[model samples]
Target chain A: MTETGEPEIDLLSHYARSLGIEVSGFEDGVPVLCVSGIDAIEGRPGHFHGGATSGLMETAAYALLRLALHERGEQAQLKPINITVQFLAAAKKEPLFAKARITKLGRRSANVTVEAWQEERDRPRASAVMNVMIARSEPEAT
Target chain B: MEKEAPHRDPANVFDPEKAAPFLFAGGHPGWLGLTYLGHGEDWTEIRLPWREELMGDDVRRVIASGPIFSMLDMGGGIAIWTRARRFVPIATLDMRVDYQRPAGERADVIARCECYRTTRSAAFVRGIAHDGDPDDPVATMAAVYMTIGDFNPAGAKND
Candidate 1:
């Protein structure tokens, strides 16, 4: 739980660890996550696949949402309502980076903006806006 | 007499023309085959083989936004993997998608993304999915990826 009174799920940490992402450095606001490369994730003739990038974007948004909720002293599970993104460029031979921030924070919903870049941050390869709905934290009926 | 057809490539590979058969299926009634076409420098493209199972409520119709979103999720994952320096299966923390227009009955869906920069703890990435039509789009999305280890692009081993 954070000072705001919300509990942290360590979403980024748990998720990245499961995927074998090796990352360093982190701040309370935003953090950088990493993953390794493999054949199952190849795109086109031989470049990096795009689907992978989309997954990263979606996951990042979730992580950010979790953080925000924790800061507000609220207990809630975040569900994405919608997301819009534009592919400005491509990434060839470097680890992709995602930068996320809250665009709108409401009682029932939250909006976030995320940018993905390859080697350079100035020239974003892709950008996205995610809309999320806050739901009561409940375990799925497994 | 019944003759059997030769074993060709799996329904899903990366053929743009054949992709329609897979992508156009919409949310028919069965599983479909798809793949990544690879995007720009750090992005990834997800391609699927058009299949009859994609038919939707309209019979001759394609899949629905729900299924399309599922495909996007897969595509997005591939995009992140493309940018990853090492071999790891990253998971989606959360994602949201907006449908600009219904997906056309042509070409495969290329979900391009890039995990360009990573801070000390969080990895940021963004991407888009296009079936070729730049003027219009089937859907657009953005998401964030979290890393487990120290992201090392220079330490990648391409298979």
Candidate 2:
């Protein structure tokens, strides 16, 4: 647990790491992900690809779900059920930031919302809502 | 300073198959390793092969949902272009993906997208992602794309 008593997880070793995404610490008790826009992720000329932006937001949601599970002391497999993404603005070639919040957490599923921003948090380039299915781990034999 | 917009020939028919190499060569699509499978009048298919580095959960060996989203988005966009028969500047406004099941650990995922409807400014698309079998899809997706500029097939530039 960190200063806020939230369980810490090493996200850098995940798939986002392949795209140069890194954990930038926590904000308001939520993990934030950051990624630098490079030529590999560019779409049209000077703009960031919509797919990359969506990927960043989804990764944030996954991290949030993982943190939630850890906080609840539940060991289960998390699987994505669905995800909806809205592109509000054309992402520019700059460092991007993303954070997620759990909207609902039930025994068998979870709902999470995430936002990706370039500069100001108020100005989000893209946002996403995801539903994750939780398959609880079976108790180990005594 | 104001810069000139890229030239576009609206009359040029959009051939997604022929343009696949250039479109997926150096960007996110390229990074995801999207390959052109085939295309029809208003539909296109693309594939994403499995790779260890693309796994979201290392222990589970499951691929991340992000790359799959990228693949479907590209597939959907290509479907729209094929339906419109012209390359126009368009932006994805909103997209929703439903994962029916986790993709097979060692199987390549394929997405087939169809542009079902289009208006002056918006195109509606739907698709399915499957691993070797269309009947058993890994995910389903619905999306909308909005045309940014005038649809001047003759004057639109292909970038």
Candidate 3:
């Protein structure tokens, strides 16, 4: 966990894990996320769904920002203010992977960049940028 | 290509089977589907069945903007889904849509999407839609996705 300042394990990552999003590893300012095809929350064919995809994008960005904050010993509610996604290709197989990077981290706001890819990195299936708002966690920690 | 009949019933309007490749279930209202028609590696065609519930009073006379956007979003999502994985939940982080023409009741919405490139974590995609001609696109979109979890078809509890 290394001493980043804030409490270890960003709350949002815990929620994402509860929802079944698996975190492979985080290093060099990059957070990696993966999900299998069979475990997809939505979709009818051997393809993924868009709304669900949007949810994933949000999750990845959220996780990256949280990790950055943890490293800085800062705690806050990370809410998405805006997001922009680009669908590059279809995810054909199972076990998709997503990587996230924080483009800019500010006191009240942050911007994150993430990409979803399957198999190889040469071609990405989708990519996104998310703008998030930082606020105090309600109720204060016990 | 088979011509899709305009559905009068909002509840039965979205066909999961027809829109199978692209449709995704689960949302506040629940039961949502989007379809893509015609196909090419770099380009494609799409269509979204009209439903009354997704329409607005002003757009009621025409197809609502939200549904149209949903269709484009779904179409673009499906375009990417076809390449990397099968039947996994994916979510959109953000989307931008350019509406060129107003969707009418009788006229069905259509689109074409392209996946240019992708990295380990994200994919980049682009698409366009039209009523009849590709030259006159009714809508256009660029989107991003986050891939998470396995299909777990039986929805079984892991040991």
Candidate 4:
């Protein structure tokens, strides 16, 4: 695991893990998340749950933000301020994928954009814009 | 095109009690342990109990944003059904959630949604999620849903 740039600790939350979300690697130095259509995240029988997709997208956003924090060698706690999700398509029972990037990274906050897709990357099943507040584990330097 | 399955006749009144079991049985709502609490003419209230497994920030002891977001989405759907009284089929077109604070430690979340307006092909909704007090909410949501009498499970341009 150390050989690769992936973090040694798990980036996903317990709920995400229960839904079968995983860190599938990275895209241009950003972490990507993937999940199989399990019963836990099932929606309308044959489709993925809307909330499950939102969760995966949020996890990806956090993953991207966490990496940035790691790069700065800073330990911080994240507080979600807002998330706006746009449902683009109904997902089927298959491997769902998501990735996020930092649109703006400030000293105490970040804005991220994440997209969830299945099969075709061009066509996203859902996309979200997220704003997170960072509470530093240690006080910022004067 | 997929064949249409037999569905309940469209009515003007919705009963959350009757729909609870079917809606929360085996889907993501089931996994989240969602329950129907009560409803009004155009609104629905649902609950999500506390579970260690659903915590977002382990240290803060707060429920993740995803679960709260999920709850609001489902609550909004039920509200639409309650208002429209026609549970034909609905999809979340867009939702914007603003977090005022995180859920209290080990506190169950209560969400209430209202379908304020409905057109021929869409519904607009608003809701709030709180741990104990409705006055002080953990989050608030504004959403839009596309209502279609004939639902297709395959996919839609805006699902």
Give per-model CA RMSD.
Answer: 14.9, 3.7, 14.3, 4.7
The superposed Cα distance between candidate 3 and the true structure at residue A122, in angstroms, equals 2.0
lDDT of 1 by residue, B68-119 (tens): 5556655555445445432333444545566665556634555555666554
**Collision pairs in model 4:** none
The DockQ figures for the candidates are: 0.06, 0.65, 0.07, 0.66
**Tens digits of lDDT, candidate 4, B4-66:** 322234533456767777788777999999999999989999999989889886686767889
Candidate number that wins on lDDT, 2 or 3: 2
- Tell me the spans in candidate 3 whose CA falls farther than 4 Å from its real position: A2-7, A11-15, A42-44, A136-142, B1-94, B97-159
The first chain of model 4 has a TM-score of 0.93
Q: lDDT (0-100) at residue B102 of candidate 4?
A: 83
The deviation in Å at residue B29 for candidate 4 is 0.3
TM-score winner: 4
Per-residue lDDT, model 3, residue B10, is 23
DockQ, Cα level, model 1: 0.06
Which segments of model 4 are wrong by more than 4 Å?
A139-142, B1-13, B150-159
Q: In terms of lDDT, which candidate is strongest? A: 4
lDDT of candidate 4 over A37-112, digit per residue (tens): 7888887768987899999999999988877887788888888999999999999978899999889998789999
Q: What is the TM-score of each predicted model, taking all chains together?
A: 0.47, 0.91, 0.48, 0.91
Local distance difference test values of all predictions, in order: 0.52, 0.84, 0.57, 0.85
| Per-residue accuracy of model 2 over A53-130 as CA lDDT, tens digit each | 988888888778878788788887888899999999999988999999889999999989999998877989999999
